[model samples]
Target chain A: MRAVLDEVRFLAFDVFGTVVDWRSSIARAAEPFLTGHGIEVDPLVFADEWRSRYQPSMEAVRTGVRPWVPLERLNRESLETVLARHGVDFGAVTGDELAELNRAWTRLDPWPDSVVGLTRLQRRFPIGPLSNGSIAGMLALARFGGLPWNVILGAEIAHNYKPMPQTYLRSVEAVGLRPDQVAMVAAHNADLRAARAVGLRTVFVARPLEFGPGQTADLTAEDDWDLVTGSITEVADLLGC
Target chain B: MRAVLDEVRFLAFDVFGTVVDWRSSIARAAEPFLTGHGIEVDPLVFADEWRSRYQPSMEAVRTGVRPWVPLERLNRESLETVLARHGVDFGAVTGDELAELNRAWTRLDPWPDSVVGLTRLQRRFPIGPLSNGSIAGMLALARFGGLPWNVILGAEIAHNYKPMPQTYLRSVEAVGLRPDQVAMVAAHNADLRAARAVGLRTVFVARPLEFGPGQTADLTAEDDWDLVTGSITEVADLLGC
Candidate 1:
């Protein structure tokens, strides 16, 4: 473990539910906007529905069924779908207003330990996002949440979503490092599994509350990851930062 | 000018001579290495010769004479050319040593006002480098120099060098902003002109010492840029940061 730690030169993180509390943050931003539009659905449910579309949407691009599209566009399209399913009159909302509401993804709040933990980790390694988020969205989220990333990597730059081998390989190459020299830190076993498959060292940080109460998935590390910890701060400690 | 500033949503900068004191930094790094190799040459002159190859080397790619290559590769090739011209024996250096020395470009020092001024500017805008430097090189330079950029943009991501339209246009698009809504901050008049020609608002920050005491160009703004300032701090003040 110490030898592997010694080889890690850069760290890239999964952003959405890992670094940021996207469920509550999206729910929080959706509440007022939905209420303003005379929509009566629970905002958390709305957030879930919006997020539930995330993987399937990317799967379309990953399978080459659809051309490459930015995650921002995917989020907005999913927003409209969720609104229509809730029986909201989409014609009443201005395009500008819809665009503003779709930007909620960029306003996510970080996990309590994210800023300080990443800052400490950054002293040892250059850190950035390795999520499916677009670079534009990542930039806004970094500013909104005070993420101490020195560079923004992954998705849009790779022109592919995560779980695709290219996403991990391309991002690692972008920083001029071999995969073994880079670590993928995430809350999901599947994300780490995919990264590890591509020669990237994997650290699984638990985010049990990412989906709120009754959350069942990703509650614990599903495999013997390189480092499995209860929080980003724990990951930092384990990495000797 | 005020209207243009109001519309600017992101700021991309030229890294080489705009943000860092590259000539002196390269010279400082080269002095010890060259002396150890028994090479009799002024380090600054070596730096100048290395930089002089930058444009012509990139022009090959810009004109499609060679397939795309990262700036790191270009820098190493230029280093070899400079060393051979000065009569250094190629057999003396190991590959690992050459690779380490080639990274001097990543170890540049920022100007006195850069860190503080950029920190202030970052408080208002999403700032990044839109240089010919590769993503790996830019990441290293940002870490080494303590640059307060929220994202790393430009060349490697765009797959083209500067003075090329796609470099500016693609970088702007990556951040989800139009050309008019992005500002190109640079010290070289030719670079600003290239950016402005592509509809990006231009700001010229003077770096008279970028080429050292005998600097003969870009000492003053050569055109009507959106903002022309003596320092990055002046740019921050003018932008109301």
Candidate 2:
């Protein structure tokens, strides 16, 4: 592990669950949106329904069932379905309002330790997101959450979604670093698995409550990831940052 | 001017001669390499010769004479020619050494006003480079000079060199901004001209010493750019940042 840490030059992050609390953030944003439209629906359930569509939407692009589209488009499309499920009339919501509500993903709040941990790690390495988020969406999220990044790296930059080899390889290539020289930091075992499969070092940080109090998966390291900790700050400490 | 400012949500910069003083930076990097290699050459002249090839090399890709390539590749190829001109045998230099020296562009020094001005402007808007440099190169430059940027934008992200409509338009699109909502800032009139043609607002900051004391071109604004100033600090002031 020491030897591996010695060779790592950059760190790429999984943004959604690892760094930011998207479930509650989305629920918070959805509550106001639902009330404004005179609709009655559980905001948390709405958030879950909207998020449940995320993977299927990306799978369409990954499987070549559809052309590449930014996550913003996918989010908007999923939002319509979520709203329709509550028997809400789409015409009641203005385009501008929908766009603003869709941006709830961008306005997500960072985990308590994310900023401090990232800031500490950044002192030793260049850090950026390597998520499925588009560059624009990541940029907005960074601004909203005050994520101190040295660069933006991710799916949009590679024109592919996460778990794809292109997303991992192209992002590594963009920073002029080999896969071994970069570390993919995430809270999900599957994300680390995909990154490790591509020769990138992987660090798993526990995001047990990411899906809420009833979360049943990804509560602990699932395999021999490069590093595993309870929070990003713990990861930073282990890295001597 | 106020109307233009109100519309501008982001600011993109021309980096080489505008944000960073590439002439002296390249010359400084060249001096040590030449001395270490037991070669005799005027560093500044070598810098000028290398820069002279920049446009022509980019022109190849822009005109379809060659496929798209990063500025780092172009700089390296140009470096080989410059070294050969100075009677240095390519075989004598190690590949690693050549790569380190080619990264001279990444270690450029920012103009005196750049950091302060950019920090001020960044408080009000997201700022980034829209130069022809690769994302890795721009990332290094930002780290080297401590440039405060919300995102890294430019040629590599767009996969096209500047002065091309795709370069400007794609960068704007990546930030989810329209042409009118972004300002292209530079020291070169040609860069501003190209940007303005694409409907982006332009801000010209004087860089009379960019080519040293004898500089005769771009000493002053060549046309009515959206805003013109002696330094980025003044531009920040004008924008009420």
Candidate 3:
């Protein structure tokens, strides 16, 4: 931890499942929107399907199979597909309404310790979200959830999504910090590994409930992270900020 | 103003002169850094020269004379040149120290009415700075001045500085609003003209003290702006939001 403090100047966060309870938040947001039309569907199943489509949709842009679209558009496209599969018709959902519902991703509830931990860490180092989400989406989430980020940065600025070196590099450059001076904090092993590969410090904060009840992975740190803590609060305590 | 209020969903602001007192802020920040070093340069002159270099430096990038560089880097390079010309030697200024000094742009003091005006406008529109400053720089200004911005959009994201259509378009796109749905509120006629060319609504808020007395321009609407108000508060009152 002292080693981390010595080198890390910026703390970049991974927003979705790492800092926020996306599964629960998405389910909660979608329930009312879905049930309002008398559409009877399992909200959890709907959320899982929504999450499932995220990667492939991003991959389409990453692989150049589709043009770069904002996360809101991609989410809406995926939502429509998922609802259609559940026998829900698009005739009831206008484009504007669908766009608003798709923005549910922007209002996810942070983990109980997330905001408090980030606020503490921010006192010592510049802290902001470094995620695959669009800057607009992240900003909306910050405003809605009161996430006190010094700045909001994401893949939209880099034109490349997470696990990509450009995504991490673009964030570091945006803050005028060297790669080695920025630390990537996340619950995802892949994200931390990518960040480390690009010469950034890494801190692992385990979110055991990240994947819901059936979660089997990411329950503990899988690699030698510079700092490992049970929660963002523990990480903040370890950092002594 | 009523016509604009009915359609405007986003408001992009110019940072330095429009929302903040840049000359005073820059002079104040540079004073302590330069004192007792046998470098008795006029802080006001330093501030003016520093700002004077901004447009030309950005023009170098815009015209392809220089590669794309963040505003912080541009500020550093220009600062070094300007200080050398002023016969001030700062052999003691380390790279880190110089970088921190460059961030003075981020911590500028807001205009007396900026905070109150922006707060009222934020209730009705998604308000943020649309400037040539970097995201980190704008975020710092917002935090230090208590500016309530829903997002911070800058040239770093657009890769083009203002007076360019991309700057205005990018701000609108970042907020998921069309050009016509956004309003560009600024003290500069050129900025408003650029925004107007792109179909954005425009409002001119006079900043008589922007140039610190003997100001010759931007004291009144130059073009047929959608709304002209004596101050940002007046603009807010006119918008009724």
For model 2, what is the error of residue B233's alpha carbon versus the real structure, in angstroms, after optimal superposition? 1.8
B42 in model 2: Cα distance from truth in Å? Answer: 1.8
Model 1: residues with Cα > 4 Å off, grouped in runs:
none
lDDT of 3 by residue, B153-228 (tens): 8587788888878878877887777888888889989899999998899988888887778778788888889988
RMSD of each: 1.5, 1.3, 3.4
Model 3 Cα displacement at B53 (Å)?
Answer: 2.7
* Local accuracy of candidate 1 as per-residue lDDT tens digits, B93-121: 88888788899999999998898989999
Clashing pairs in 1: none
The complex in candidate 2 yields a DockQ of: 0.74
TM-score of chain A of each: 0.98, 0.97, 0.95
Instruction: Report residue B7 deviation for candidate 1 (angstroms).
Output: 1.6
Q: Which ten residues in a row have the lowest lDDT in candidate 3 chain A?
A: A1-10
| lDDT per residue (tens digit) for residues A58-167 in model 1 | 99999888889999999899889888988988789889988988999999999999999999999878999998999989998998988989898998878889999999
Best model number under TM-score = 2
Docking quality (DockQ) of candidate 3:
0.45
- Fnat: each model in turn: 0.92, 0.55, 0.45
Output the worst ten-in-a-row residue range by lDDT, candidate 2 chain B.
B1-10
**What lDDT tens digits, residue by residue, belong to model 3 across residues A85-114?**
878767877887787778889889999998
